[model samples]
Target: MDPFAPPPFGAPADLGEPDPRDRPARLAVGVVGAGRVGTALGEALDRAGHRVVAASAVSEQSRRRAAERLPDAALTSPQEVVAAADLVLLTVPDDALAELAGGLVATGADVAGKLVAHTSGRYGTAVLNPLTRAGGLPLALHPVMTFTGRPDDTGRLSGVSFGVTAPDPLRPVAEALVLEMGGEPVWIAEDRRALYHAALAGGANHLVTLVVEAMDLLRAAGVGEPGRMLGPLLGASLDNALRLGLDGLTGPVARGDAGTVADHVAELARVSPEGLRAYVALARLTADRALAAGLLKPEDAERLLEVLAD
Candidate 1:
């Protein structure tokens, strides 16, 4: 068994990378959860020439998704998947990863010598300690993209960032694998995994919540098409914020319009108290960032802070 040789049988076809890195030899991969992320990643790895031997899909929806996304791979149990594969992709929930790994190890699965990876954003290689202790090579591959379990979801994985956390010895192997998956590897330290994941959740997940809340408020205020109203404004805002960061901060908050801010707070308080609290919290944070960015003067922010505090 040559280390650099591709999987002899039961592997998918070969592929290329975005950044023109070398596509490493394919491994016998097994996905231990056929959820959205798991199925998509398994497909992507298959496209990268890896042999997806089997996948674990419990729910009906998951089984269907696995059949769709991982058609080449057989459906089976987690322990079987772990045992059969050279690389095991454990794409379970964050909370379930440890227990799953422990259970597999306890059941005398051959975790040792396998590249045991999990697609958990909140954790790094640390969460795969059970596998590691069992002599498995731990890899944390977190794609910083949302999934819909649709047909085209796998195509979107190209040219994206993957928060990769692997041991120093396995760094090249992990990164090469990421490149083969058509993603750039953003090395995340074991210690900073939580913060790294937090930042992503704060930006992506919280942005979704904020946008939905805004739309709800718009609907509450008798706006017929909340999406239409917010579409362009949010598009530009997001573009600017991505390009300019705090310099992109705008609205009454950035301008330090205390009375206007007060009016917003009062209106939200009257109409939607939930929106009011969020508005206040975000506005204060925006104002603070604006001041720090030198976009807002001390004297200008004083009244705004006073109104926000009130």
Candidate 2:
């Protein structure tokens, strides 16, 4: 099976035997922040037989998203939403999560005995200590897919991997909720959540920058429809990297062609000086990986590294 291939739509995640800590099959769910992630997950939960009873939406855009995707859920205040549901999803921005949890507790919200989960890849359950102190069962469930808040957002939930962090007693509950939403739960330890999120950002977020830069360079060189030219190449490169790791590397740096790499650096610096730094940095890293992977000999890597440094 290709690791890059998405799972079949509606495929069930293998959760093995059910555990005692698992909640009832149907839950009254509330969303504390009706952002893209919140509404999408709320809709997915509704499709999974859960009742989306309430959701808090401050912005007009968020309120519209909640109305469109989570039609059954009433738009209310965060405190009211928490008070009305068995499970509450706090899908605020990463920086806002701790404050939201803390504020919920500060306002004397009825979080006691309720399952409260936040969708922040950079955080673990520890960030919800404020709510935990108030007797709320805190869990972190960060979905590994990007959300655009479009109608198709709910479909993206199918077969997605959710980074989950929960206490031992609530592990079953976390996995069950992920499975119910058609996502595979990948358990992440508390101490490693930040690193895990960083890896994701480095890959997905930076790939966009790299691709856009490439497209810009191509357009500058008078290549019309840059996407058409890059689509197959990028697709194959991604698949190769997934399958072969560093051994999949190609191009001048990977082959230790110092002259070609030097020419690339010279041309970019001449025409697109702003992108020169990133190109050099990535080339240096690629040369290191290729050298370590035995794809480039030490003699060739020495020359390659010299070109990048220059």
Candidate 3:
């Protein structure tokens, strides 16, 4: 079978994911905020055979991005974007989403019977209450991937998980849209949206901080190419952690080596006083996990706890 061949409509593919051909009929897509995410999704949908009719871009950077990704889409105001498309993507920041929706309604945007989807991870369909009240179909479809507005951003959408939350009757529509965009839909309840977003932020966002701190330390220790050195080690550690959870831990804290951990704490305090607090906190959490997982003996954990406390 040709990997790129289109799947038969209404038939499950080899991976059992939703078939891309099973999506709704082609519709005119509109992007309300032509930021990195908005343009990327718009481009992906365009690749899936939907027409990008119009896009709203306030900043020069956003306008440039929309030009590159949705070249055929007319640059217009937010109200005009909503008025021209069958599906409107609200890609604004999380805090500004509700206000944007309210403003669109107040400005007399024609949203009735249109599919209004927001790309906010923190919110569900509830944030689009204004649009819904105006007879719009609301969908909360958040792609679980970072976007830098580069040419590669749209390509990254393939097979990425989308946190989807919609009314029970609209679940299929929500999932179908994700499938069309080359994303897998993971159904998220409205109440669990915050928790789901928090988990992603804690893991992916905090991991960046931790890795950058490690690079800074490596440079201080005279390593010229920190990324080259950390690349393999971090890659393996991430793989192990994903495959084994707590069992993948192998550092001094996981091994209950209080002396080594104490040395680390002392060195951090002396060399990088600002990083000492985060080190201590993460070390304590690691030790607790190791102990609970039975990887560290009770006697050994007591020494580790004392060092952490100090």
| TM-scores, each model vs. reference | 0.92, 0.92, 0.92
Predicted candidate 2 versus true structure: per-residue lDDT over 172-265, tens digit per residue: 7788889988899999999999999999999999999999999999999999999999999999999999998887888999888999999999
- Give the TM-score comparing model 2 with the true structure, all chains together: 0.92
| lDDT over C-alpha atoms for residue 295 of model 1 | 92
Please write out the lDDT profile of model 3 over residues 1-310, one tens digit for every residue.
3211221223123354354424555678899999999999998887776779999998999999899889989999999998899889999999999999999999998888788999999999999998888878889999999998789998999999999999876777788789978999999999999999999999999999999999999999999999999999999999999999988899888878999999999999999887999999998888888888899998999999999899
Clashes of each: 0, 0, 0
**Candidate 2 wrong stretches, greater than 4 Å:** 1-25
Model 1 accuracy (lDDT, Cα): 0.85
Q: In candidate 1, what are the lDDT values of residues 1-310, reduced to their tens digit?
A: 4322222232224344442113455577899989999988888887776768899988999999998878878898888898789899999989998899889988988876778889999999887787788888889999999998888888889999999998887887788878878899999999999999999999999999999998998998899999999999999999998998878878888887899999998898889897788888988888888999889989879999999899
Each model's lDDT comes to 0.85, 0.88, 0.88
